[model samples]
Target: EFARAPGTSDYAHNTFVDFGGVTAKNVRLTANSNWGGMFNQYGLSEVRFFSIPVFAREPSPDSGTTDVDVDVTLSFRAGREAAKHDVYLSTDEQAVIDGTADVTTVTEASHGPLPLDLGTTYYWKINEVNEVETTTTWQGDIWNFTTHEYFVVDDFEDYNDYPPDEIWSTWIDGYGILTNGATVGYPAPDWNQDEHYVETAIVHGGEQAMPFFYDNTGSAAYSEGERTFAVPQDWTKHGIKALTLYFHGDPNNAAEQMYVKLNGSKVTYDGDAANLTQTAWQPWNIDLVGFTGVNLSNVTELSIGLERIGAAGGKGVVYFDDIRLYPLFSAVVGTFSIHPWTGDGDSGISSSKTYTHTGKFTGEGTDGEPFFAGNGVYFERDTNRSGTSWTLTGAANVFGTTNPVTVADDSAALARSFFYGDEDNNHPVLTLMGLLPNTEYVTTFYTVGFGGAGLRFVDITPGDNLGYPTRVDQNGVGSGSGQLIKHTYTATSTEMSFMFDALKTGDSWHHYAFSNEAVSPNLGSN
Candidate 1:
């Protein structure tokens, strides 16, 4: 007879026994041969019994058999790897049972084994299967035991679900909150308002306990003339998971400085105070991962304090609101998408000559007049043929025309009013007047040929003759060497002039912009 543990490989030097008709003896087994090393190949030896012998006698006394049920408990060790286990029962060692498979696997590192039959010995084994690969398996020694028919436990209760309570706050002023009352007695700040001021409210003890404090007040000791708040010593003990803050900048002051202690170490966040504007509120969210000293495994507490690090007149204020502490699986990052405008309200248009709230130009006013509440500009195109030569039909009022293109032809068509430059000529300039001075503007037009084009700006004094049309392109050819191109110019002058000439050639619709300033005077004005 031969018996071996389940899943054990039939390799060299495994324990084995052999019985020929009467007696059995221990034998050394190897991959190549059985006992006596007789055969070069190995195979299992079968045993048959002429008469069965009882190992032990059952207890008498006319004792009736009693059945009992016992619950089997299972536990696992190891971090993530130790939590997985498989339980199985079998009677006939050679027969495989399909429906009896226990599919309810436990995810927690420790779990229970349920009730089992008593008075009858049952064979059970646990397999620590690798989660990443199911085929790789390891088995524990089989356990045999009998259970009592019935057993009960008193300390059994259902699990309960509770909302997460841990919370973390970061830079909690002006970035998100708004103050309502005077400098002294303000109610809990509002989040909807556009303005924010510096202050803190004790959420746990009720407003009466710690009333809010402001940076300008004398009670809060000032460091370098600005108030500061530091994280509590027991921050980590409270189970804080995340942090949030509200911040505002002071355009005149130097950057602000704030420090926080995470997991017993202090880290600083340098605030950009010079860029702060009172007109709008900007919210900031800081993740615990943003701090290296903090133990994010289970953040307990966070401390925040601020100081004026900038120049003396660098006073800045921010409002704080919606301070929170909660447990979350992961942090969220911000994302942005580039939005382009076509004639339609939707984006992703296929045409090269598409217009945004700002217009695309082919000639003059090809795009409709500033419709839709004047959110965009109009464009025009003119490729009129005067005998063999070509001259774009000039418009009297560039902005006044509804549909600027007068000529209609597929090859020589005037689609919209756009400017083009010729590399054959020095970069001439083009200017449009009657524009808002010192304001941002976007001037877009198409040019053909030329790899890239440059802009030349000239400031025209009031009452000066500005009647100069700079050449954008010398020889305006569609294919041979030059074609359509685009250019943009940003002008910041009170009165300026612009003209376009080419630096190269390529037949494509181009778009450029002049932002943060206005356009200059036109070529015709003096």
Candidate 2:
């Protein structure tokens, strides 16, 4: 049933009608009477209906997204007639759905960059509200997102050159103490009061890094920079397993054992000794489980220090940044190397190299079996080249400098044989399996060139981080020994890989043996 207007016109005109607050699913219309001017009884064309919009739609992060930042703003499209929005967020899904969850009513369509915890899934919803409308509330659908597992303990980004905010002011170093060898910042050339002390050029992830200088040349045995928390920090949250920090060293830095102290418990570095000399930024992931005698839940202090490894003390500058806490990653957090070795047979061992070899004589010497006398990590011979290139399947032994070297038994079998391939068609790849993600490893490779074969260049590229394409040059004058090349990388996946490309046409590549070892925060096994 409906009402009709009395007036009539040549063109079609719209009619207005009020239902006075009625709720129905269907509506019908019929002709009560016809105007006198019309030829027939009555006529009807079409009819349409409209109402106020209810629910909030279109979530910003959508839903079920993982690895979201802890400080993420929840936004959505508000209902058409909604004058205000009620935001509800929580870790419990049932709470958000029941309307009893924590609610924040706002005029805007967006909620927050909410205060959230790491490694957690949060459920959220919005209830659109308009008090004047007959239907005052419209409940929204439940949405959820997960935050990242890791949290930043310190990035050094908050520190500045100003007073109180200065990096050295917070990170107390041995600048004024004689017993400690650490000087946190650089000395300004002029008496400029507002001089920048933190290292700006060589940084790990941010605009600045702490330039901790160590001078153990005098009476000091070690250098350290410590920071005391204003309030006790609880490291036992978010299922955290490791504490990771990035350190960049100068080439002139003295080789010292880097260590971090939790509260007062010390955990010395287990990586290569030469890492302090390499100019690249290296990650030192310390396992929290290893910090014995410290209350992880109530962490009060943290210290980064370098201790003297030998009788003689050395000194240099090392930059530190991005000290963070990390949980075990399901799918590798960073890149890592698989191979590890003991001795450096070559020189110029970068932070990448765990060990290098300098010998020239090959597995076979001038005679049938010459004396193989050198302290090195030896690999078992792989009779088949194809199998060895794909998988290093042989027993490896690490020999210290003090260990006695045998002539025929040890040196003759020292892994000098490798897969020979054409540069254009075939390239060798070495793969190491069963590696742990978020762990750091050191890989070493032994390569040698034939006599008078000119300077052969080969591109050594790791599958993941540490760096890509480390170029190795082999001078083929006549040395029987091979050069040891090593690389350091964190494992981003369960497997580690390497690709060898011989840049020269005629020159070939030979690998006798290799080794792998986990350095920082060693879990005993990979």
Best by lDDT: 2
User: In lDDT terms, how accurate is model 1?
Assistant: 0.31
The residue-by-residue lDDT of candidate 2 on 113-227, one tens digit each, is: 6766777889999999889988788878999999996788888888776689988888899876888999887756233653477776566555777889988888889999999
lDDT of 1 at 208: 19
Where is model 1 more than 4 Å wrong at Cα? 1-213, 216-242, 246-255, 258-271, 274-281, 297-300, 311-317, 323-368, 371-526
Predicted structure 1, TM vs. truth: 0.25
**lDDT (tens digit, per residue) of candidate 1 on 198-303:** 2222111112111122352223222221112343222232233345433323223334454555544555553333323321122233445557855555444444
Candidate number achieving the greatest TM-score relative to the actual structure: 2
Candidate 1 lDDT for residue 189: 43
lDDT of 2: 0.65
Worst 10 residues of 1 by lDDT: 152-161
Q: Could you estimate the TM-score for every candidate?
A: 0.25, 0.52
| Regions of candidate 2 where Cα sits further than 4 Å from its true position | 1-49, 57-115, 119-123, 126-139, 142-150, 160-162, 190-195, 237-241, 327-526
